[model samples]
Target: MVWLTMFYLSSMIFLAFFSFFCLLSSFFSILFDVSYFIEWDILGINSNFLVMTLILDWMSLMFMSFVSFIASMVLFYSGGYMSGDVNINRFIYLVLAFVLSMIFLIISPNLVSILLGWDGLGLVSYVLVIYYQNEKSANAGMLTALSNRIGDVAILLAISIFGYYGGWNFYFYTDLIEEDSFKILVTLIILAAMTKSAQIPFSAWLPAAMAAPTPVSALVHSSTLVTAGVYLLIRFSAALEGSAAQTTLLLISSLTMFMAGLGANFEYDLKKIIALSTLSQLGVMMSILSLGYPNLAFFHLLSHALFKALLFMCAGAVIHNMKDYQDIRLMGSLVNQMPLTTFCLNLANLALCGMPFLAGFYSKDLILEIALMSSINMIIFFLYFIATGLTVCYTFRLIYYTLTGDYNLHSLSSVTDESYIMTSPMLSLGVGAIFGGALLSWLIFPTPYMICMSLFMKTLALSVSIMGGVLGYLFNFMVVNYSLNSLYFFNYIIYVGSMWFMPFLSTYPTSKSILVMGSMYTKVSDFGWSEFYGGQGIYKVSMSVSNSLQLVQNNSFKVYMLSFIIWVVMIYICI
Candidate 1:
């Protein structure tokens, strides 16, 4: 295990350097307007063939760099986080497998190879989600796997449709694809991306997946698994331009954002609040992408990854020191005990809230501004800003409960930031959280965005954010009797708190119907029809026939002589 830890750390260092080099290369390539495509023929029939294709454009390279960099930090953090686990080696391997799958997904331009990577992410994520091997972990893993499988099936369907284009290389046919055909393809791809990214109907799995270890949660929810869908759409953005798929994504993603924000405000679990925050941010990215700003969405994707990963690591540190206690109600005033960890946590939270100049600010502010400028429905327009306010609202609520409220834990509980391994990765990511957005913003968008909106609309984002902050403080910390669970709105609170009953809607009805049908089928086919027509029926019929035969055999002996004599007399008479 010690050797494995060292090996993983060394790999992280190498990955960091490689990521920097790739980012540099991508930066230069974009500056030079360079694009490269590489392909290798792997398998084929007479007319149909599978070719492994990879694109080395700025998008792929830059995204790959970010993925590698984050995975490296996660692996480093896991060293201290999983120190007590006996299967630490297995954990490391699974994380590596996850990173590799993400890399594959990142580089491929062909749907076929992307499917390979996509399915790999789903499989490896399930393994990681259930790594604890408990009932809770198992159930969470099942949900994660089943939900992602929906996306996998969608991709397969999209691939089948892409076969009409003579090849699965979507990059080549972005402009060549017929509008009608591209419409269907875009919808399939959006469905796939939606599930992977945990949008709307498929959103339950992201927070549920917190049953995994904290490090796994950090990695998966931040950059690898959940972002897979966003990245997929980024790659397919060209085909999706001017399509209805974008409108559909815009509507649902905005709702998802608002829903997750509302859910986070009601959630008490520390990690789950962060998980919901991730879900909300994912909606932001998807909505921006749907609004014809894939580049801006990609920028936010990278920026959000930096801060969100840091947020998770900070939460992991707090949870580790608090004796694995994750409930926010059980925690308070951590600034006195674990100053460094709390500092990182607060920084990440502020960044998540789109604080000015943080990683989230550069991208989030840009997104809101551009969203305001775009001529969208008034409802969606307001939902976008309201979602932004909700982000600040929940984050401030989280901060009040976790970092500023009175100490709520037992006096004996020891909390410290002495773990160098854990803090080192956290501090490293903390730097990224602070600066990664600015750096990536300049690199990704060499040209500044031109914005034109009314003064009131231009200031709406900040106004909402400030109002949310004030309300968050007043409701969460200042007020003593405010509760969403009060009799006034219990039902509404429950419905919103449960993420609009998405988890129940996705699981309960379908599961109940399947179970009922299965029971009926078992009774009718397995027990009733199978037994009667199969073993029992055969035995009964055979037994009856044998009994009659025996009776005949027993009576025939005595009667045979008389019968034979009668038959002979009748024949002679007739003759």
Candidate 2:
């Protein structure tokens, strides 16, 4: 029955056209009632946002437009990309559901409502990531799911805690205004957002996520999923106002930016490099927004969604040409092959580097402006400034290496442009990537500096553009010659080895000590690593505990259940 329904041409038309209609309906809903929320209470169940004021704020509406616009593009692109691939009908259905969830997420009014939309999108992403279900992709999907589920659990706990003290109603966030608990609640929510957004320490999943098909990465990085962090931070803007937590957020964000940019330089996989670069950029935006500038973050997010989407689809085209090979080192000089794909890829990278008159310039420069406001310490400001330099390093590195390398693959020529289903939308996205930043408004912001954004910000954007282009060429040598044995970089063991310098760097040398003479773990540490370390016994004890757990699971379940039943009978008799 499922095959009969989806295999028909008419059914394909209906599914594609139906989702388009849904988008139109959603847009009109935003158009008419977006000023403030008008909601209804559902005492017996969860409150729905549709009952609140129409969710037509500038932010929600803008994101909704992005959802529908890019979604339409992806759907159209998929028709060609998936045409001959096996099990494509299932892919279409999942894509439809994914788009719907994002639209709902955009308009959701309360935390519960937003979570509903958030998890829906996440579930679809998990399905899509493992669509191939090979060993690599399966591991990618599971790790991504586990990391995201950890975030979800934290969110669930925070919501339960808030509901206990605040109210069961989801719309009651406003009810807790000026309360200390509300601030704590927002902080917990921010932690959940950071994990979802792939901020550092939790960031390893994103590179793994590249195992998914390229279009999935396009959608994930571009619109719905990754932006959830910025959305949550912006949505709860006032709650985070005036907290010391902003500085901590800035530090984490800066670290993610630094590490992702650095990691991108070292990775061999074409898509992984871009993925790392994107994670870094998103981290920088989240950090800047947390420091009390949401609009700047919004602009950067908007532009990123445009260019990153283009870059991923174009990369997909390259992979499709090469029969799914991912390493950039093996492929090159396809100016004739996949001309449209190459063009779009370069255009997107240009925008990503924030070249003047491109979409990225408007957004990234705004972030730099916020960083330079002199309210924060000079050291922190310089850190963000340095991050901007790193962004350039990674963005244009892909640009230089991918196009400039001579053909290394055996007997391969550049194919012609992608089919209509692919090329048309790819071209449109490239257009957007080029012009989206050039056309910002003076009236909306209306400041002396704001009016002159082109004159001021564009200049900075051009300089960064030059920096990226120049550095990419200069270090094209380093990118190709990157060695594991030389600087001993990517040797995480070396980084760990260097942590012994902690005592030297620490202001409190005594506090930095890992030794506690009588403590069990320390004694084990001393035994394992050296005469000075003692964690070996602790490791042995942990292994024993793990073996004990294995025995109970294997041999004791029936006995445990029988004992539980006997204890229950004894308790009842006593009662």
Using TM-score, give the best candidate's number. 1
lDDT for model 2, on a 0 to 1 scale?
0.70
Q: Candidate 2: where is the Cα deviation over 4 Å? A: 1-36, 45-54, 164-178, 412-414, 440-465, 478-575
The estimated TM-scores of all candidates read 0.91, 0.77
Residue pairs in candidate 1 whose N, alpha carbon or C atoms collide under 3 angstroms? none
TM-score for candidate 2: 0.77
Model 2 per-residue lDDT tens digits across residues 175-246: 565677666776777788887898855676777788776777888889878888778777766666677666
Instruction: Please list the C-alpha lDDT of all candidates, in the order they appear.
Output: 0.89, 0.70
Q: In candidate 1, what residue range of length 10 has the lowest lDDT sum?
A: 476-485
Query: Cα-based RMSD of the predictions, in order?
Result: 4.0, 11.0
Stretches off by above 4 angstroms in model 1 are 176-179, 478-487, 526-575
Across 325-353, the per-residue lDDT of candidate 1 in tens digits comes to: 99888899999999999899999999999
